[model samples]
Target: MKAGTPDLATLGHRIRHFRGERGLTLDQLGELVGLAGSQLSLIENGKREPKLSTLDALAAALDVQLADLLAREAPSPRAALELELGRAQASPLYQSLGLPPVRPGRGITDETLAAIVGLHRELQRRASEAIATPEEARRANTDLRERMRARDNHLPDIEELAEEQVRASGHRSGALTHREVSVMAERLGFKLIYVDDLPDSTRSITDLANGRIYLPPASIPGGHGLRSMALQAMGHRLLGHQPPASYDEFLWQRLQINYFAAACLMPQEASVAFLSQAKKEKRLAIEDFRDAFGVTHEAAALRFTNLATVHLDMTLHFLRVNGDGALLKGYENDGLPLPTDVTGSIEGQWVCKRWRARRAFEETNRTTENYQYTDTPAGTFWCATQTGRTDATEFSITVGVPFNQAKWFRGRETTVRAESRCPDESCCRRAPDPLAERWAGQAWPSARLHAHVLSPLPSGTFPGVDDAEVYAFLEAHAGK
Candidate 1:
């Protein structure tokens, strides 16, 4: 394969290393290879790519194989340090400082290079930590959402891993049982131990040294909560995740673990088979999927996004919105115009009142799913939303698809329809002119600020986790 910019840099470093080992000056090597000293310097500094013939000649002249000259590894420890410094200086983060690049040469000792690289790494760490701010976090989330949309929100590798583990645990059908989950944990060399004093910030903790997974003593209402938490804890080990060094990494790890848990709860092969048959019968519905998998409505809706496009050739979107209209979670590969901030993040933004996600809150029937067809600027979509509640807030989970593909779903015939022109101030953002005129200056409502908006993101190796409490819990249970 052809080398990219970073690979070219590695090749250049290898060539330079070979030349130095042979004690050949640039001019002498250039003379032997029939190239100018300036040309050779350009090749060694990674400023230019050498022709295949030129590489062969240089490799022969330096008494090394072409493969050796093209190797990706740094030729020496000092060369590795030099390469790191070069990359740091070339990065946009370092360039933003408006400082001149420092060239590595005889005058620069390895110790000095090490110090420079260390400082650059520290700068990068601080820069990453700065993203914990709300605006920055939104931008990061926006970027990650775009990545998911591009891939249809499917992770084949994680799916395969979950399938292998699930099959190994002897779970071949509906609703992975609590006993099966414990068996899977045992297969991974872990024992599940429920305790009453888990840190409030954490749902579960894994003591790697002791091969124990500590969870809450009380059973969660649905029973899936504890199962999901246990699988997520094992996900870290199964997925080979390390302590995240930045907010972006922390978010990514959380997403992966959540996906893993869902995949285990609803194994892909089984889910696809079930969904395929449902589609054939024109009865695909989130409620059936949720009941079949024994997961929450939100998990079933989110998992539909994972498989719908890949297996059923149906693009879809999902939304979890609070009763107050704030978007808690969202994903779309179809052209649904979910509300977004300037940063492109949908979370915490308000959903349009005309859309089913928000309108579901106004419905009186809380037991059954609410279905509607929305005509949006992008296209018309049919959605089914189910209202749910927790001790802290009331929310709704919605799964939707394009109008053309709605025929395969169970609620496609619903006559309820509406129009939305979101991102436009007139859609739901602005009140009617008469109402605005009547109430413009008279209203002085107090706004309720969410605690997350004012607080900085949780700080530590694992964000939001209280390390002291976790350590103490582990210490107390070590002898048990």
Candidate 2:
């Protein structure tokens, strides 16, 4: 009954075992312990926690020590089997099957009990393995996000490394040139090689043996993609990263390389100065930041989050949402409410329809960025969203901050404003009452399933990458 005591079920089973060994009925044991037969039955059935004094009396009457009465282990093999069966039946997974609980009576064979327990365990193991990749990935992402938020998304060590690399490349400029990127790679003892047969799974591959960094021959938009990829390849060597052993390690390494690349491209010293002067003139903007650094809008928006809080004393959020309204990537330290799954991951969740990230796709003007102010349960936030298209789909990149900080941004004068009550079904998830009434039971549309969602995550040391293909590609290129 007290803390650290054996569970009542096991204690009860022990007591019953001792009583049976003594060849005594419940009434006889009750008489010996000065209790009614019904009370003794309850104690034996684990429906009552026997007092210490009662346990002492029963122990004495049953010819055993008190310690024996309260032992943690089940008294017999049948008792252990019964306990296991009871626990398995009580589990959420078993209950979800809607099957009736099987009580282990004297008629049940020990083999039958063992088989059932083994089957349940196998089911549990398979279920855990099936979800382990995504579940653990989400959990890792959530934990990493918390750590990044705690440090304002700034890694001083990586920043220092990037700065040292930029200085060594002699980049003293508005935007890092392809020449500068190539110089940095060469300094890292890697020769940049653009090849037509690069592996599809990799953006860039570093051949450590030959000291060559292989990239695709195709031109990336604005040349920023090529530069970024090359820098990221060099980053592994600069940062001393090894091949990751687990999915979490792989994700962390990927994030580090990305941060390293961005820091090199935007070189904290110049970026902070540019942003400070913009803030001085009350004209801070993602487009200006992108143009100033010659990076993609999404890259600039993400880079802004890295420095905004640490250098500019601002809290902010950045989001990249596809035209379909599914959030692809998101980060926030400004308390801006973003949709998340049960695992606390924002990826693949739907953004509110009224938010600038989703609404930007509706604008007829595809030439410029869209700006809006949205009032939400958290607070009002002003955002600037730029819509862009890739070969596959159109997506929007958004950078936003609380209303108080909006005054320092370039798009503060936008007349567009809206209200949202997200995470609530009534906000944007539910159809209008009139429309629902008109089509409540009449609509039955087939849903288009996302392939990634339908398929299990690809299994490998580096997920989704074919090691055989990579090795073959390396061999083919080795002779070149």
Candidate 3:
């Protein structure tokens, strides 16, 4: 055994230890790392070298320093992504990172990123093959784990499944209908609730990453209408099989996943590059972002709020509101009385006023909106701008970016930009199964986790299906 190597045997023990300390099971950890347990187990067994991003995720999920992943004299091949951190180390602050997980998702050349993405594609491809043996899958893993593992765990209990799917949909923003997403979640024991769907004023799964499902006293459709979730909605995520032991541990797990998604979606280099460019441009322009990247305005705008200490910058805030014009999640940087992880509320009168005005307000004075550092999660950020807007629709960006080198003290508010976000809602519909999507031509490494969000390796081809029919839906959607 080598001095610092996080060898397979000990690695598994340590991993299991860390996971237990956090009170997360293999399934929960996989969800945090955006992977399935089998694939993760294979990694634990040292059967495969984690792609750099996956390794970074494991670090975050485990709350270990990136370097602590192993004591190897040299880093894993995935370490290639770490090339720049050495340069980043010029400052004493970022130097002793100890291989802590820093998100390494996007910056690789499209080719390199594509290569890493190919690993996911292969993973997906293989899962598609296994979907055929649905029964065999159930026997291999725990109930909830099996459901997630199968990714095809659709069952007859539609309503129950929808609730579960809604909860999982919270894993991301833009949730779909309860009816639609439920089918997906129930099969897996996911729990989802809605407050009011109308401006979607409620707890957002995208906001919390991993937490309980919040159900409003009144559904969006009203007392007697369809199930609807609304504003100020908040809840804890049901870990399906493995329940967390402590509250802090649960919150920690949630933060880890939130960070993981951010890391995976935006690679380190590209993120900095983007900030620098945004700095040069003064603010990020929304339309340019959407057309350029094929993203919805809400996703783009929300991306702004997701910005945290991963980079340096002045903090910004988003005002989550209720239909009645009351504030649910307050507007504050990572500072002041603002929440460290959850959203706060505004006076109900504010809601009425806003509804009357039919507009949004930028709170500048600390009197109405200012939070202290402790008020936010560790590594809080500030100074970001809006980026999702189009000719008609608009999304509000909430996260902050690192401050500009020439930044100065002044008015706290800026329009920055608006993005015309795409309205495509999140779907765990489980229709045709994710296996179908791979056959239909999904983008590799798309944060969405294609057909094979489960299974183990990228082996086994979906033998019987013809490639042409496999991609029919995608082709049709692409049809002119």
Candidate 3 C-alpha lDDT tens digits along 1-480: 345565554454455556767888778999999999888787654566677688688889889976666653223343422333322433343343354433444455545644644554454444444443323322322233223213221122322333344444443322233444344434334445543321222223222333224344342332211222221122122233123332323333443333232222332334446655765655544334333333344333333444422343544444444433334333334332221211121222232221111133343321222211111223323332232233654323323322342132121244232211111112112335567766666545637543532543221122222334324422442322
Off by over 4 Å in 3: 1-242, 246-251, 286-294, 305-310, 328-331, 334-358, 361-480
Candidate 1 lDDT over residue span 1-480, tens digit each: 384323767778888888888999999999999989999899888888888899899889988887777777889999899889889999988997899999888998989889999999998877668448777778778888888888899999999999999999999899999999999999999999999888898899999999999998746578989999999999999999998877777888889999999999999999999999999999999999999999999999999999999999999999999989999999988888888877788999899899998898899988989999999889899999999998899999999999999999998989999999887889889999999999999999999877888777776557778778889888999999
lDDT of 2 by residue, 321-411 (tens): 9989999888999999999988898888999998999988989997778899999999999999999998899999999999999999998
Worst 10 residues of 3 by lDDT: 419-428
Q: TM-score of the candidate numbered 2?
A: 0.73
Off by over 4 Å in 2: 1-132
CA lDDT of every candidate: 0.90, 0.88, 0.38
Ranking of models by TM-score: 1, 2, 3
Alpha-carbon runs more than 4 Å astray in model 1: 1-131
Task: Estimate the Cα RMSD of every predicted model relative to the unseen true structure.
Answer: 13.5, 11.9, 28.1
Give residue 80's error in model 3 in angstroms.
64
User: Candidate 1 at residue 314, lDDT?
Assistant: 92
Prediction 3 TM-score vs. true: 0.26
- Candidate with maximal lDDT: 1
Pairs with steric clashes in candidate 2: none
